[model samples]
Target: MIPLLVCDDSAMARKQLIRALPAEWPVSITQATQGEEALAAIRQGLGRVVLLDLTMPVMDGYQVLAQLRAEGLSCKVVVVSGDVQEEAMRRVQELGALGFIKKPAPAEEVRATLQRLGLLDLEPPLAPTAPRPELALKVNFRDALREVSNVAMGRAAALLAQVLGTFVRLPIPQVNIFEVSELHMALLDAQRGQRLSAVCQGFIGDAIAGEALLLFHDLEIGAIANLLGWQPQNETETSEMLLDLASILTGACLSGIAEQIDVRFSQGHPQLLGQHSAIEQLIRLNRERWKNTLAVEISYSLEGHAVHFDLLLLFTEDSLSRLTKKIYYLMEQE
Candidate 1:
């Protein structure tokens, strides 16, 4: 049985990867929290495969790759980063990695990769984690972050319904916390073009609120304009209006959530963009630092006709602190 090494700074990511692996593979798996720990693991034994994430606090994956190459270590490496840029991909290939797995790679795909590498004989069906017990969540901080999205998203939808003058129905948005690379890829689907436009604003309340985002397609701009009762025009003017519309929606949506969650946050004006390669670029421009991340996907109809596709909110870690306080306050009141 080939030995397998899983290295990532995030505990959540590590658990997800473990669950995705073939259950019957006789391979003994080892863990590393960061690049230094990975080096220590290598000293312990020569593993056949090392699944690594790119970003970390003490040392990054790229640096680890450089050190390993310099020392002439030759373990088969599989990158499991959220970043899938052309340059990033090229760099990893240059660093002697065997392959890449986009974050949240389907369980089947993870199994297939191991088989192709001759690491596994058979694959097992992927099973989701069971819901945690209520008492467990009450004491756990991470679970509270997940629930924040559920409560906030519900309030945001109600606000959307009122603003659009129509009933807006939406499922409770699922929260998937990830590194910037993974978060960026999920938010910016490849099917969409390279050129992207967005509206961004900040919110401040009991806890810090990073801002909400409304990302959209240029071609779909006309559809949105029609829904809003505006005539479409040339590209320049149309682009401006789209940004404004996004700003209004994002502001109202986030504010509504804040009020319901028992937090008061002040929001800034929306910024317009003609081209943004990564959403993190926008975050950098805004000078926002977040401790946590919460993403809420929103889909609602405009006037019972055209449906607008927008992400309601993406909260940062610090902003998430506010959510935690609010939840406990509400729970105490209950």
Candidate 2:
């Protein structure tokens, strides 16, 4: 059997791709979590055809493609990424990727692509199958939430870009249900060994009320100030600039999310949570308040800049049932 490599930082993505492959096709599949590992596997003859994800820690797909070209490696590469931006697509094509597939790839499309590439022999397509009974409800809700979050994130990024005058790079907004204690662990990407300054703003609308926390690494202050065309000559000025930045981002993001759910939010004044504090410490201090909250984390990266921050929205436990119903209602409308 021919060997195939599926490389993605997300285990779920890799599994989805594997499942999407034609059932009748015979191949040995290998998996890698990042570009470096994927490259190493290719060099070792683990696979000739690679399905790669672009956004990964340690090494991304772009770097892998560049290195592959530099080393003159012969491999068929297909990009599978959540970043479906036009520029992202053009860059991967220029880097010699055979094709690009957006996230949440349809199984039929995957099968067709393989056949067109001569990787799978031409055969009759299989009939559609119903989703398994146990997995249907859970999968539908998660998928709907993810899709809505994607749209909202794009809106937020667009607003941020307008404010920064530079393209804002957005990763896929992650949606998950985790206890407040587990939130610190889930946010390791945002708190990667940096002292953070946070701003918390509460928003209420009908039965849905949540808090949006904007977390910025203290080291990002200068870059943010310059982006906002502010010359902070003193500590007070710096603090003001930081708060202004947080207000703009959190406002735009929360507004975008609310717009999607057909809710109007009354936002509160931004409250400064002390600077130069560990992220875990900040969360731990308020752990009791949010112990049972449902948190949605969105990490925003500014392109052409060295600024990175996270926006976290936390909903009270009692509001979850209402939130889920609203989410489902929105999904049904779509």
Whose lDDT is greatest here? 2
Candidate 1 structure quality by residue, lDDT tens digits, 249-291: 6765665556546666787776665555536575456433532
Q: List where candidate 2 sits over 4 angstroms from the true fold.
A: 1-139, 187-189, 278-285
Estimate the lDDT of model 2: 0.74
Instruction: Please report the TM-score between candidate 2 and the true structure.
Output: 0.60
- Evaluated at residue 315, the lDDT of candidate 1 is 69
Q: TM-score each candidate.
A: 0.49, 0.60
Model 1: how far residue 172 lies from native, Å: 2.0
Model 1, global lDDT: 0.61
RMSD (Å) per prediction: 14.5, 6.8
Error of 1 at 175 (Å): 2.1
lDDT of each: 0.61, 0.74
**Residue 233 shift from truth in candidate 1, angstroms:** 2.8
Candidate 2 per-residue lDDT over residues 191-244, each given as its tens digit: 677777878888888688877888888888889888888889987787787778
